[model samples]
Target: MPDHASESSVRPETPEPTGTSKPSRATESKPEGEPTERPESSEAPGMSEAPEFRDAVPSPPQVPAYAQQGRQPQPPNPWQSNRQTTGTLARLRPARPAAIRNATLWAAVATALLSALLLGDGLGPNLLIVAVPAALAAYFAAQAAGRRLRTWSAVWAVGGLALLAVPALRDAGWPTFLAVVSAVALGSLTLHGSRSWLGVFLGSVGLLSSVAGGLRWGMGGVRDRMTGSRGRWGVVFRSTVVAIGLLIVFGALFASADAAFADVLGNLIPDVSLGDAPWRIFLFAVGLVGALTAAYTAAAPVRWDDITIRAGKPRGRLEWALPLIVLNLLFAVFIAIQLTVLLGGYDKVMAETHLSYSAYARQGFWQLLWATLLTLLVIALALRWAPRGQSRDRTLVRTVLGALCLLTLVVVASALRRMGLYVDAYGLTRLRISVAAIELWLGVVLILIMAAGMFGARILPRAVAASAAATVLAFGLVSPDGLIAEQNVQRYRSRHTIDIDYLRGLSADAVPALDSLPEPLRSCALKEIQQTLRTSDAPWYATSWGEVRARDILEKRSANALVANCRGQGSEGGSGRNGVEGDDSYDPY
Candidate 1:
């Protein structure tokens, strides 16, 4: 047979003097060394054109524009490109250096131990000690992991420490509670480069996410080491176990051998009984998780600002302006009425309403508070929907929102004035003072909004947050319970009325103020606080400054005399009241 492979590979020559009479221009335009088509019938049986003889050929790869211009193609940025794959999970999965891992582990252990020792007592000076050290440890761990602390991180960390001092300084429940919340919020913002309201919210969420992610990352590292390497880690683990066993054995023998050594050991180590073991373990776990979360976040903070939320669709000038204008007019009318009431017309209005001053104040204050809150919400929504792209739109937004904010300030003032009147009639309570403080804060926030409007809103969210933190700090520093006691005592001196039961409910921070009351009343006021102080056997480390001062004050007084007078007052049902009937509207929150 003929050589079919060679025949198939070679292109068949065109016959001279083709039927077309002359070669077509299209065929003439074909490039040299290109393959020519052949009929299948001309080939041998079961043979066809070879693969190389096919009409189509792959094209050469195109050169990039930069490469063609004598520049090398830049590598894609890992941070800015391929967001889908390079997300939080991918970032968290990188192998940490052994040194960094060990440092993080040590920091977590230290935090856990500190928390277990100091936290079980109560909220006190111990919180300050534990929190500051824990923050420092997290900072060091982050640095060990090659994460540089940013300026805002330092600011937030310092702010958190300052807020944590509230518990050490004030024993008032609400102030301490608010301070802890503010501190935790600031802590979350430490690593996350948050600069907006959305960023703040996501930073909080990221804190929780870091907790679980850090646990998984840490456990994975441990699992890998346990399964992969039996050389160094195994010996280290075995040595640790041996050391622990030796310590337990030697410690017990030595404690049994000497009384002074036993006392020292008992004092040095926390007494973890079987019943308290679970609680202590829980506290330790919290500390470990908290520390690991902070370190993990610091090492790889999610760029939450990258997640952009599109603004609300802009409304037409008419659509946006009409409601706000109507609302502004309504506010103007309300302010007019409020101003009239603030003037000498308050008595006439009260008489027309058939309510006393306190009664009238009570009826209106809560409504005004709710109105103030709702107005803030409305302002937020208005700004969201406000028209912007045009000069006219900008002016409209500034004018309308500005007026709304200004009117809201007046509402805030009205709420505060109403609360003041209510307090004057009934004496101050924790709830009254707290609400007043909140109203004052709202007023400050409205002022911030107006300022932001005048200048710019870029810093408004952070400014608002700082203001809130400052308000809480100031509120704590003022010692709300002490102030309440002092005000009520003064009210009693002037009006000959006070709420003894309410005063008794205050914390030890009120001791100095309550101690100034006349005999039986003083005894009744100090009765509960004294009981708390007497019963509390908290160690010196857990005692707050407020608690220490209260103890000192009580020590100088006659407990026996106070107890005797308190018993007589209790027998006579001497729980003083402001003589006004209790109204259901009086909520002390």
Candidate 2:
């Protein structure tokens, strides 16, 4: 051992033996993956005694334990995140925040401008046509800039355009214009990928227009959506043949019983109000639309024929029972009508000479026929096109109700005309307008009840019952002959006696109310007031009635009211009394 130690000391002390020996506590205190410790002489003066351990081999500050475990600190995100970062972030983050903020600010400015324009009077109507388009362009631009782009603005814009287009749709070249638009819309649906919204918009437009056109065509040229595949020629030819056959049958019946059926169809079909040339043009346009719809429904890309078409003939009990039930109902209706006519019911129920029970009965026959055909067409279409097991009962019920409404309208029209109110062809009378106002109120209630029914079906039994109740309430409350109705001048004159002198001294608000009273009553009231105002001989007050009346006129806020009074020259009030003897047609002003 002495000889080996002497050799080791002389042989340049082998580094392998020194390294393999256990390190001292001071050297072991440093961690692995660090540089070897330096000599004590290199240390600063009194470093060990100064209570400071200045590290010669320093490592970066150690990460906290929580951070190492990933329990507190987290990886950095390119987007916003509550995390620590050890690397660079995404470049897009900075720009996106500013872009979103700017886009939102622009949207706010546009909305405010739009609101201001709409609130103004002349600007609103003049700009209304272009307002929707301008608004839509701004909305779309902003939406694309925003995080999520909603496509609903596009739908609204198209709807607004349709409303504006209605008045201009009856032009001489309108048919060609419509056809072009329809074709464009239909073709747009074929677009793929990013252009899909364009297709949806165009298709929706075409569909809405088609619905309106179909209604204007009435029942004669209605299309079968499910059977559109057979082509236009086949459908048109079939319709023509049916129309001819019916006309021939009608002619033969008329020849046999001219007296009975002469007046039946006379009123149902109105004469050409716009002259023959225009009427023919109208018919041709209507026919074109009908033909186009039929062709499209028959052969559209979306196959609807498969569901409707049945390869085999029906052999079920339904076929037999349905015809029998229909026959029984027709027979029952005929019997009821005959019985009523024999019991002097016509005399009792008839309201006007123009529109009578006999007229309604005549109209009902054709209406019922048209309605049945329409319902059958809807049923056939639904059966063929709808998914299996989806019933057409709802549609059929709706059609039946529509027929009832038509008949009810005619009956109500006659009743109104009998009460001395002027009614137009579509039953648009002052009484009807009054009823409509009341009906509008009832409609609000109907909506509430319908909403409640969605939650629990027991809220309302049937919509029909509500409709009938509404009609009855309207008839009872708003009818020209109703107990409290102000339609009759005589009733008003008999009820309230207007003090002419007192009214003449009142303000413009009270003067305008005279117009609200029945015409004859207004005439009498104004007459007495004028006599009091114009004459000073028997007057209670000592003032020029004209000066007093002019003062009353100046108090009016309405420009029209002011103009009407100014035109009256304060003598028109007396004219209501002395303009004519007992005639009620004098100016009520």
Q: Which candidate achieves the best TM-score against the true structure? A: 1
lDDT of 2 by residue, 270-349 (tens): 23334454544544444334333322221222211122324334333344235434644554575466456445665654
Instruction: Point out the worst 10-residue segment of candidate 2 by lDDT.
Output: 89-98
- Which segments of model 1 are wrong by more than 4 Å? 1-48, 51-99, 144-146, 223-269, 561-576, 581-589
- Candidate 1, RMSD to the unseen true structure: 9.1
> What is the number of backbone collisions in each predicted candidate, taken in the order shown?
0, 3
Model 2, C-alpha of 258: deviation from truth (Å): 81
Candidate 1 matches the true fold with a TM-score of: 0.78
Give TM per candidate.
Answer: 0.78, 0.24
Instruction: Count backbone overlaps in model 1.
Output: 0
Q: Residue 482 in model 2: shift from native, Å?
A: 24
lDDT over C-alpha atoms for residue 580 of model 2: 22
